[model samples]
Target: MFNGSPFPVDAFPQIIRNAIYEVEQHTQAPQALIAASALGVISLACQNRIDVCRLNNLRGPVSLFLLTLAESGERKSTVDKLLMEPLYQLEENLFEKYTHDLTVWRNDEAIFNIEKKSLMSKLKSEIRRNKDHLATNEKLKVLLASHPKSPVRFKQIFNDATPAAIKDYLCGYWRSVGIMSDEAGTIFNGYTLNELPFINKMWDGAMFPVERKSEPEKLIRDARMTLSLMVQPNIFKGYIKRKGDMAKGIGFFARCLICQPGSTQGNRQITSPVVSTEYLPIFHQRLMKIVNESIARNNENDRLCLRFTVEAEKRWIAFSNNVEYEMGILGRLSNFKDYASKMAENMARIAALLHHFNGDEGDISLLTVEAAVEISTWYVGEYVRLFSKPQEFTLAISEADELYWWINNYCIRLKASWITKNTVLQYGPNKFRNRSKANEVLNTLYSQNRILTEKKGKTVFIAIAGSIF
Candidate 1:
């Protein structure tokens, strides 16, 4: 039923991994099941022997018990009209209204500081408006900036001020803080994983929906697995070889010229051949698990998971086809299938290695060259724009010419520096050899009338020719 094609069978791994992560993410955080269970807790608390007074934190259960008691006719039906229905509506309205108020508070803080000119004034205003609740200015800033549903930043400012004041300042902030703190106290909680930048990125990207219909646990779990796979240690060897040398034994360093019969080292005809050596049985298993779980977990947004699973399957099929075409193991279908599967086992390791190590070149030499060219082009264009005007020649010609002269002088040095500059290197582009080469090329081009020229009031002009005619 998807895109007029039957669902792919190979997507099982991704589905299973996705599902496992989803469940795992859910388990890492606390869940709220207020309706049935909370009411049960309240009913138990009603007994004098149950120490109901001591269960003051049992508001959730008590609320549910009241609803149940009303339904049983011990309380008037008007109570539902007055409280239960309104409470449900109020809960629904809270997320949007609270978030809007927080946003307003965040924006107003800057104006408040600008107008009031004192931290004390801002703090007093907040406390006066919100029932004498006390919070640091920074804490308020962070709270207002974050989503209303998000846990308060109690940990960050806990030591900056007294805990007693913070508890007093925010009206409903305490409830959320308490919930988040309770969840953090548990052994398997968000504290460990949420500290990571990647986790926060994924949470912001996947969560914060107007209505979070998709399960939060699934989001966390899948995001973690994806991130983990991305950051996992890579231990694989790969080589880039010419296409014609495809038949040769991999990892054997015989020249492409020997294999291709007409390729050379300098002017060599080349095609990229990727090879790798790493074992990833666990990764594949996890991937399959995710795919399977996605199919089974039919949430409203399950289509996204299904689509990704399908794409993975299609990629595998394409991979299989490439293997069959390369192996020259012609004829029987079974033989082709077996050969393709074996090739895929090898390819997966290479793919995993390349995923991690592909950008280790820092900035590719060619990319650096392109960037240098772009910078030079921008500078030269600005120079021409500045000098090409006749009325704007109030400054001395030599002073105006100095900018162009400096570019010519430094061109070689700039080119040399551009190529060799790297993260580990403390030196700037002016110190690199590749920048020197680029500068040399620029100078040579300038000398040959390849750079610098203009048009002047229906006349042709050139720098090397020194003519405007």
Candidate 2:
């Protein structure tokens, strides 16, 4: 029921389009398929030190938190495996390379620790003996300071890790990393540990404070992360039910680019798998190119500052004005103004990604900006359709109210004071859906003193209070 066309994969590079196509051919889940590919690209882009647009002195990082909702049989895991295979391979390779260096560093660190302790003890002993042993204390300080620092493990991808763990990883390795998961329940369940603020702060590019009682001297700042999670709709709905307004109020869910793709269940046809393909090679090549660039920049401590061309800047302004105007109009996009307001920024990031993927230039083109605008417009429609309600009723109307209104109107039309439970189930409005839901509504009505329920011979009947036949 998502009332929008599928994401425009054609606007991206050919390898991405082909990869999506190949995955869709196998899985028959186009939305999840495309989302996985796009998330993969964004993950790589975020790993690189790159800024997308500089408009009015505001620079946006090409990082996004994307959430895809689908049912259990939607092949989300399959898509994830296919798209994230490269990152897994890269991680393995890095680990293998770092193993020997880590071993050497560990031995050196052990020796350094002993030396540092000896120096500290010597300094304390000198100070205690002389009370004015500044000369000896200074020599001990120099010895302690000359010890080699310990080695840290380098990591690129994390799956279902706590926010604090992720922060530590980012601090140790590259300053940026990606958090990806097929079953997003782990991330949602982490809220019990009160990790929302950490997650939110990371998304906003704010400084993170890593406090440690043992290492009070270490300071961690400017850590960045991107998130990609695919969850079932039922789990998402349950999360909303449990958290209520807190989810929206905290802007945690608002920062996500959410997509509820249509189900492809029961429509899959068996077909022979494509044997040899050029898509994977091309995909890996493009991805590795970006990964190499990011690694190079990280080594050199340089970040690419991308600026929009003059015409692209004009186009972006126009797009922003149109989005603002549409969101400002009552009943237009008022239900999802928060998401609408971020469309331009997200588009800029996407445009920057597209620009980088195509060429190595640090300039965004008008064509890319236009493509970003088109894609953002589609995403806005998706958001609206996902959250919008019909004019006759709002989401605020409770199921009990809807059922009560239906039953009251039905009895009044029939000029009857009472209706049997079977009749209500059979002839009530479609909002009831099933007898169980209808019974729940009936129980609510009876509990509220709005209706009278009587049971006789295994039959239940309900009558509206203050009603006349």
The model with the greatest lDDT is 2
Instruction: Compose the digit string of candidate 2's lDDT tens values, residues 134-173.
Output: 7667766787677666555667677777666776666665
List, residue by residue over 389-422, the lDDT tens digit for candidate 1: 2434444334324433443344445442212112
Best by TM-score: 2
For model 1, the stretches where C-alpha displacement exceeds 4 angstroms are 1-89, 117-469
TM-score quality measure for candidate 1:
0.15
RMSD of each: 30.5, 12.6
**What's the lDDT for candidate 1?**
0.26
- Window of ten residues with lowest summed lDDT in model 1: 228-237
